[model samples]
Target: MDRLFRSRRSTVYSTKGIVSSTQPLANAAGTKILEKGGNAVDACIAVAAALAVTEPASTGIGGDCFALYYSAKEKKVFGLNGTGRSASKMSIDWLKKNHPQHIMPNLRFKSESVFKVTVPGAVAGWCDALGKWGSGKVTLADCLQPSIELSENGFPLSQCSADIWQGEVERLLQMNEKDENLKLFLPSEDWSAPKTGDVIINKPFAETLKKIAKGGKDGFYSGEIARSIVKELNKRGHPMTTQDFSNHTSTFVEPICYSFLDHKLWEIPPNGSGIVALLTLGLIDSLNRNGTIELKSMKHNSVEYLHLIIECLKISFRDSDQAVSDYEYFKKKFEADFHSDAEQLLSSKKYFDSRSSLFHPDHAITNKEMKEGVPNDMFKSDTVYFTATDSEGNACSFINSVYHGFGSCIIVPEHGFALHNRGGNFNLNPKSNNCLEGNKRPYHTIIPGMITTESTTNPAADEEELYATYGIMGGYNQPQAHVQVYLNMILFGMDPQEALDASRISLFAHPEHKKLSDRGEGSDGPSSNDITCVGVEDDLDPDVVEGH
Candidate 1:
């Protein structure tokens, strides 16, 4: 019966330990670290860094990141939010000087040329994590060693990449006609498909690796690498400044925890979308005040659950639109009140005042699939999600991105790092959430996950201790992914892999993926994916949950 719900058939093993990500190369590299006796953190660093290099279309040093980690020894969770701020130079007034209306890349959304650029913070994030949590425990240098080498020596290209390059060659080369780095990664030529076991290499990337090996992550953040970035973006008339490079930093916040079933789900705070997932799961729990999740209940709950979640997301995003910004600005507009009480805020009736049964049980469900749908699209283009767990019960769940891939499509020359156009998500109409601002961090696509158990009694008693992180990659579906994964795994009692493999959803208030039935708000696009995409054909209500 589970066969109908399976997502992937491939799983590879590594001696280093264990790492699971969308990209096989990164997964292998992370496993290598574990095999080498590195812990979950060490393995995470190795794979995540390698993904930045080998999977540039998905993520790079210039992107943003969010994470949730569980320390078995401490029995607590730590949240690391790595969204970056705009360069001190990046302001609405400054950008509009050269263009009409001064809207950043309003025209370039289709071109993705040199004009679409923003400050990057992922490199600083990796460095910060390694420096503080890594230190002597796990040599920061060691975790990134493989990535450095891969960048310099270059790894072979997968068939999926070759195909994407073939499709997007013009798009890839539009920014830098003479740029060898872009050309090499997304070669314009098709060298035929891999024959079972083929090895491809990247030499320029190899040189890039060598530079990092000697300079450390800082080499990319503020030194020679930073210089290269500034030079390249400047050459293209981009407005980023050196201050942007130096100003990049990640934040450590307490994970917003929500109770569901017997476990608590945790996710990092804004500029990430993890809050949406936490709230959605909470609403589901609030609804199931008395009953265990049965398949019939699960199916009926899918639509109602989605209605509430989208409503919560609408509310949360409203806050994020206004309050969440780059850390500095958010600090002013959005107070760091760990007591924001996500579950309380979401369950409040004042918000999410919508009817249940947004979908019908009698109707045939749509066959909209999950995943980035691009496969490589998972990390190769816009976003990626990776999770790591060790026998010691130490776990880390991380989601990072360059935002729609290759980030803003502007490469900072010497830095060999591409800038992200995360700012593009903003609205300039003045009447919208997420308007552009100086020193404000763009809202992010990441939502890191964490798993933990609480004692059965009020005071204290024995309870199961489980630690893990699970994430799904998709733009609007991210937090929804977090919620669906938790439902199938915790509420339904499925394994992590199996839970994610089960049927899932792509909940949204917007109409991008959904097929809208009414002539109401967000009535554009194919509404079938949204309208017909809920509930299964012949499954029990609680037996199967969908979307992840």
Candidate 2:
């Protein structure tokens, strides 16, 4: 019996509604919304706001967001791109004129530098989602009330949050010993990180939240808050202006999709990397159909299965790396080609047959030699994902992030919030599709995922059955993790908790990415060239362990 059930905890069973988040406070806030007659979207807003307070290191009002909402009435999924754009003046030309030495397309400037900040899109995104899908049972102010109270009254720091906060504060301190941006996060007497249970408060953040709640989106975008943001940004030598904030608007776009087994997976289109996940699913389906890798023959978590999945991920990432661009570029090309390019690459049998020919059943590819594709830099993402499902069947998959922990470490001293470093993801090379440009969105790693079953009668129609609103929130790991979690539920028939608790495999070496190291701007640690340095738990089958 013990061997049969390996989950850390039992799956939660809820009838009226359910909310899941990284922080308990966020989960509670979302649940409270649902209990108070709010739908999934409204609950999501509450959860997102609470997370902005409780998980400040990874998320905040200063970051960006992406959402996938499953509308029960329409029986369809909707996509939201709440991402912000780069400053109109912060271009490669500006870099050449200001700081010439750090102009490399791949190289990043200091994380704390002002150039890394983008006009935050989260506030507008939050308002936009509520306006479009909210139940009207709760206003934006109501959804934000929990977060405001949490920020003003403070909450005991959890162990995981405390550890991450401490490390980030240490990192920021090293970058600038006297940097006032992170002063509030630092301890007054003890230089050490706050221990678990330590009460942390941010009255300024509460006030800021109150202003936004009362003034609505305009409070943040058009009024005093926007002015203060621009003033502080300009004071730090950043090129951001009030117009940048005023012009910000979140978009409702068509969600990119691919079919897997009995379900369709949906994600927001680029400049986000959501397409990578869809591409991976397409490749897997292609491989299974082509008879190159029959998943039916390989056991789940078997060495062969793991290898196949890893290879598919690398290949998909390589393609997405070359293809994903600003929404405007991707949309024009996709429409112009009528999606023929995407179909030929992912759906057509001919392309998969060719790709399948490259896979060798028994050997591992070298680091440098690659006809298929090598992994790029390890994705170092710090983000949070939450899901809210109402009794009415509407579900919202929400994700928010400040990019790296504590974002740019450029806290808005008056507002008590950090600015995100999303702009750092943009390339400076003119030849690249994702090249840094004024007023353009950067390549985003944050993505939310949705899965829905096909309609019983009209299988290809837009009216699919809502299955689940699920997502995993690591940067580069997101898509790969999504693949694994999908397989866990679909292939292995595990409940949510069991699916989540199942052991994970982390691939460190991407032939395309430089091995991670302290030397690199975004790297968290040392890198390894060996592709086989995959992280697997000790609890896995001995056969799988021995095979690796």
Candidate 3:
């Protein structure tokens, strides 16, 4: 009986290498790459490629990408900020004049956010990163093969994917559901009851892959693919200019690394909410003078610790609310040169009431009056993430997304792609960042972190010497998740997989993201209180479903 019920699958054991991702296809992609002698960076790209095909709802070629790669040879870590920029042709005043909300204040969005739209930057990003870091054995096609096989032939329909699919059925089927793209991806007569194990295929996606592989990344940006996306946007009244894709470029930037509890943390700058994460850790470090914040202990989990950290969160986030913006704004606005002031602020205990508001940053700017300029790097999209490690001591934590999954679902008929709805991150009825300003990077929700510390010989000694490369994926949840999980790993000492398997709850889900996918709700049904953490403010109940 045990043999009969036992699953017939190979075990994924690895003391030498490990790959973890939201989708199994992505995991396999990385696994294959590692087996072929590809480095950590190469394995990361392979996984990303697989994710683009299998988790289309959460990620794709049209999304933004951020990664932290540790180089074994150089003994250094590099960061990649593959976020897309706003159309260079756009302007803040133009957005004020065009005030998208004026046209569709209550947009009947069938997708994540109509305002969530942004330029697609992932394909170029993937290509660029892989080019710089790939090994001889690695190739785009190698990473994509399994996904292509699954898409063109078939793979099991994940229970989660099926339930999520059904939830979006009405909206997805709005355009006759007969569209070849939709049909090629979903179950049909042959897949009536998509239970735990059912074959689902996406041949169109496979065709898309072929085009991408043959033409290189540019094919997706300039050829038939580009047209499809542009046409779809033009038809929907979006202003994504042809010149937009023509001018698109993804950059490689220095990764931001911070030292904490004998370990270093890493993140991307400005455009990502990563700075906020750093701020939170910095603030906590300031508060925890004893350098010990624990959990699972009755005293540590008490209201006192939670309360102190909550206050710390408020101060740290205020810094995020004020200074974290596009590169132009960060340079022009929060000109204090953070590092110089960070230590002083920590020593003086000077975070609250000394506050940083929009007004504060404005005053801090050297050229206070010369504000009318271009926004070259405002983050504008949703995101996804993954992590991988090679025995060679190289590790990578990556987060990428199409702003919102399928990004606006505003399909470009010609290219068969959708744009991001990142414009939605801005505020209304007030002067705000992340607005529908042209060229502004949107407020991003993906932060990939690496915890590096020397492995200590004394497990019974102090709280030092545990190295880990980990990441969390929900938008606003990204930063908070980073902080919380970092604590969970250090203070609570949970293993990486166990930490990920655990629930991630935010007092508030990012400003607009829904509580995961409806399918994220378990079939076992609602937990007692869909909500958790009384002091926080998400509308979900304590037990219905866990979020992250």
Candidate 4:
């Protein structure tokens, strides 16, 4: 077979079950659950809870989660939106009156700010998914035991996790000296971040996990844990109440899809940014169908191919920013104004054609031109993504995250976890679809992806067999990576391992369009005129880089 990228690792074939994650401990925990006769959903929950303990820098119970589960028995995919909502008191008017500094253009709410904390929904998501799809063999308590043990007995930190933890030391120290995080995370006399291979014990977190294990969702949502989160936020001048925590619930929605290469790519609907992946794939499909760009004919990672993909991604980002938002908000607004819903309008062939027409085959579109083309609108986001498939053929594509590194930089001392800063993604512009509102979810970034064989007779039918469950963790790199990895396997005939190992590109929003102050500004970086800045991995050929 012709191949542009060589695999560094072979794909493991499993007959019983498979669990893949960034940390060995987390993966082991999931595998243990599967070995005990748990289904994919149970294994995924086991992995997620274990990741919260083992990789605290990227994810925890204080964050949010999203998942796509393929139930082999039913032959259908289900989506779970575990994202949290902004505080009931949060609003543009409230921010203008209470914290005007956050409303300034190009100024982002600090990661450590109390206003950035959202109602964490991972625990609720885990409970809901378990109730809906978990194997009867494993109880919630059973699924959480591995993490509880790891947290209480202490687990050696992996090198990559150690690096991420160390990077956040300063940010942690910048919090109040009396803060409990100093005592828990920085156990050293010098208050330093733990080094690689150091055994770290999180007794407090273990206790918190115990609450969830015993009481299930209520264990975390209504008891001491809820009170602690509310007390901390209230003490910090935020208007979070225990009721807000109690009111939190996960939503089960239909997974959206885009047909390409005789298969269907599935993702969680709005609120999560999975729509961006579908939109990006739709544009490329349009280009391929119309003979504008023959993706299969181009050399993998060639300058021409990279440029086309980058340009297509820019368009997708622009459109998603305007279109993607909390499902209820998006549905209401679009239904009233456009007489259409997000899934139908955004995924329609007409929308793809209109967006794809702006793609120039030879040159990049200017930032101004991109802004003009879209009707609307619109993070090294630290996240963990892993996939599991059980012997029963059930598969779960799961993702969990804190919006940024050490989310909100505010640790709940009693709980031993940081509160996620998901509210940081909300727009201050009231007219925007993603504008902050009381008890409203922000436009979430972390998304889990699944793909299945398409029904040739009816491409849009929900009746399809599971092909794979996969995801890549990062901020905006997710959707771009999703499209790239999917195409690598489907269009280029690369194996699963090679599809993942292959070189890829990432696209960032134009600096001028971003509300965040840090856009990596430099003389050689993205300029005001550029539509979107493209970053290529070093593994790609230098000649391809120069040609672009």
Maximum-TM-score candidate: 4
lDDT of 1 at 91: 50
TM-score of 1: 0.77
Instruction: Give residue 231's error in model 3 in angstroms.
Output: 1.4
Between prediction 1 and prediction 2, the one with superior TM-score is 2
lDDT of 1 by residue, 1-548 (tens): 02343367544343333578877889888877776666676677787888877666677767787777777666677877677765566555565665444342322122353444566767666666656554245666677778877766667766544443345445556665555666454443552222222344555455555665567656766677777777877776667777777766677876666666768777676556566566555444543442322333554246555454444333333233333334345346666442353344544543322211122323332323211111111111367778777666677787778876566666555446567777665434333224455666655656777767774343264333554567788776676667767766765677766776665545443333322232211111122123423333234355334431
TM for candidate 3 is 0.76
Error of 3 at 492 (Å): 3.1
- The local lDDT score (0 to 100) that residue 525 gets in candidate 1 is 15
Q: Which ten residues in a row have the lowest lDDT in candidate 1?
A: 371-380
Residue-level lDDT tens digits of model 2 in 410-513: 77767878889888877665555566778878878888988889778676665978877899977777877888888888878878887788877765544444
What TM value does model 2 have?
A: 0.90
Q: What is the lDDT of residue 54 in candidate 2?
A: 84
Model 4 scores a C-alpha lDDT of 0.81
Better by TM-score, candidate 4 or 3: 4
Please provide TM-scores, in order, for all candidate models, with all chains considered together.
0.77, 0.90, 0.76, 0.92
Compared with the true structure, all predictions reach lDDT values of 0.57, 0.76, 0.58, 0.81
Task: Rank the models by lDDT, top first.
Answer: 4, 2, 3, 1
